[model samples]
Target: MYKYNNFYKKNFIFKIIENDIRNKKYNIICTRFPPEPNGYLHIGHIKSICLNFSIAKFYKGIFFLRIDDTNPSTENIKYIKSIKKDLIWLGFKWDKNIKYSSNYFDLIYKYAIELIKKNLAYVDELNIKDIKNYRGTLLIPGKNSPYRNRSIEENLELFKKMRLGRFPEGKVSLRAKIDMQSKVIVMRDPVLYRIKFQEHHQTGKKWCIYPTYDFSHCIADAIEGITHSLCTLEFQDNRILYDWILNNISIKHHPKQYEFSKLKIEYGITSKRNINILIKNKIVSGWDDPRLLTISGLRRKGYTASSLKDFCYRIGITKQNNIIEISSLESCIRLELNKIAPRAMAVLRPLKIIIDNFPSNKKIKLLIPNHPNNKNMGYKNIYFTKEIYIDILDFSEIEKKNYKRLILGGKVRLRYSFIIKAKKIIKNKNGNITCIHCIYYKDTLGIKIDKKKRIIKGIIHWISCSYSKPALFYLYNNLFIKKNINNIDNILSFLNKKSLLIYNGFIEKNLLQLNNNNQHFQFEREGYFFFDKKYSNKNKIIFNRIISLKKKNN
Candidate 1:
């Protein structure tokens, strides 16, 4: 609730809206999140999704999910489906069925023709390489194309031929006839349309010519009655081109474009190109690899939707770029999970322990609280048995100063059970610990021991060897070792080798009830975990470690 204050306090977009309303720029507020359906949505897209949708919701305006599928060469239905799925998972709703740039291809072509009829646009015969050469550098003004003076009749005929696939790809392109010497490079007669002989995914072979993004986006916004077009700051300069195209057209409604800073995170790359490289190179399992920062990956990694939304809200929106520390995101997940995730016992690395004094055939049940701070969650029963397993790291063969765990000849408490004292240590060939022999004090159950005589300060979690279920655990770390990926030439070398660590361990039998419950659980002192839906089956259970209890230093 307090996070919304940040958006209203210093937000330039909201201020712009307020000024526009005062100046009677528009009667109603409307916004759109137009994504290119070429790749899956990344974590950076989450902020844009929240900003655009929340702005519309706060103002009671219409929000649209428009697919900017201008380049049919790379667009596909899979990416489109993934985008919609990710948006729904984030809990945002659109006003109607998804909109696509392809849906307005016919109208867009007419608009391009309109620009040409007014001599504001022309079909150039210069090849792709020659056009770039003439575009000039930052220090020089771009020279006009030799075909710039083509007759309006000739240009219209050439454009028609391009649509009919009579011209080869890369032979010619439609360009806006703007001042080539303008300070902004984007205003230097940007390309309006290109000839792509390849078949389109949406329109198929209906047409070979496609309108460029610069030509399609703004008009599509106007056709949808969008009032405020919110996008990343990189498009700030393109605002001129956006307005130029819209104002030049005969459209009655002209939507204003507003730009905000893009989301960047430390140790992760959000660029779709780089992510695609990682996928192609097989550095990651897929787009949904938990080590990745993509939304699907985060979902697979057991992050709750509320936590992601909270993270976006807390970070707020700003005009300057900032690299958010990954730990800040993790903290949000941990905070949310601490309140909702149920408690369970899991042994990531098991060490056999035998309660020698207890009867081998006897068993007792202890009721453990599901959550320490929330009583309404109630409790679950765990069995106490002669044979149990503790984490190997919790025991030491030789006693050391201030050691709090099961050092030989030392006493410790079994969580929710009784005090136990180590009597002997069993070792196998090559001097490796195979089992620990201990004796439990029968009266110590649910009672505090005398401080002077007990000398027991350690408490650890364990599972009954007989009742625990075998499980596979996946521990994940950041995908990249470096905090920045500025040098992309050798970026693959920076992939974190320890990004994923696997272990075969045991979990409490009671956890089987969570098979398809979509629940997160804390393994007592170990860490938070969830059933891995993508890799789990009836015969075997695989879990992904959500986050460890370790706190990151500020």
Candidate 2:
């Protein structure tokens, strides 16, 4: 297991940001999570959400959830709704209605015009390829566009015409007038605006021209008076353009852009395009597929919101890019679930065990603690009977060394019940063990046993056949076959074939309490589970295995 320090302690990044704020004498601290409404939010996004919102909460300041819906081609209302749902589900509350970059279109357009009149930006007629060729490589300085010296009057008129849809798509673009010979290629006159004759999810057809993220992001942050524009480390180089725009534009606020490393897991990929391919190929169910790392997916898989928050905290904030072992995330979930998930009994691959000595047709209700360490969780009654079901994996005809479970002619303790000894085993024609005969000790029910007298080392969980409820158990494994597959083209090929497995099982009646309360239950020796909200029905109880009792594959 991986060890973690106190995540609540303010780290170097927070300390630096705090010192900078104090030096500026800023009273209100404002932070924002600006995600483009192009796809569902994934696990990586949660880190930013937690960091930004936690910082705001720590200072009792303002935190805004902003949708950067500049490109209408990919943005949609569904994505916006999903993003909001995810943030809320993660236990975060925004100050007001969510903000949209589209809302500042008019102001952003006016600012663009302001830059045009000042000769800081101009409209260019270069096609995509010509523009790329002109933007020289790292070692080479770029040549200025022939139209880069367009007069202010002509540039303003052409920009107005372009917005009016008079210019065909790709025929015109607005480029910043930053030095073409600058060392940073991103500053070599990046495109500020482009024409896209598409319907916007929010603004409809009111706009034919949309500003690029590089041009609109800082402006939106400024308009909202954001004090700290926190972004992932990938945008560390973009910080210059982020500042350049704000420096040249006339804005009321100048937010400092801070970049931190994004969250990434070794066995998982969070890119939206790759995830969408998985959905489109029907390799998985949907975005909420339990095997996926998306917030909705994790929720459907029976992970608790608190556990996810704990994971984010454990990962902490850093400027260096790193791929964390997926086990760390599983460990966090296991640790949290172990403390909170109530214990219950279940038999995934059941083998019939008949306690021939016990009274038939008699129901013995035994009270078992819901949680071993937490007495406040109270107790539930598990009905014990003559015929009960134990996991088939817990038994063996030929015992191996150090095997602690049931074997022919061996004695074992049934959890929450009696110490029983296997007397005889009935086999079918195929040599498959169909049933086992056992004798239960009458006085062994929930009592302290003398180990010398009984020599019982094997203890197993079982559910009474008479009182157990039939359930469908869905087991989830890691989705990807490889630990680290960064290339998008090869990611799908590494999809794990055994990612999901379903089994018909039996859960003790005591589990109904947890099911009814929407609580997670640890199925003794099996794993943590909860009701499958989408597939369960009156006729069939479907439970999703959140994670296993054993450590996951490293």
What's the lDDT for all of these models?
Answer: 0.87, 0.87
Per-model TM-score versus the true fold: 0.95, 0.93
Q: Clashes per prediction?
A: 0, 0
Model 1 / residue 385 / CA error / Å: 0.8
How much is 414 displaced in model 2, in angstroms?
0.9
Model 1, residue 353: distance off in Å is: 0.9
Q: Which residues of candidate 1, in runs, are more than 4 Å off?
A: 1-6, 400-402, 449-454, 514-518, 550-554
Candidate 1 global TM-score:
0.95
| Candidate 1 lDDT tens digits, 381-492 | 8999999999998899887776678888888899999888888889999899999999999998999767677479588889999989999999998888899874466778
Q: Give residue 119's lDDT in candidate 2 (0 to 100).
A: 92
What digit string (tens of lDDT, one per residue) describes model 2 on residues 170-289?
999999999899898999999999999999988899999999999999999999888888898878878999999998887868988888887889878888898889899998888888
For candidate 2, the lDDT comes to 0.87
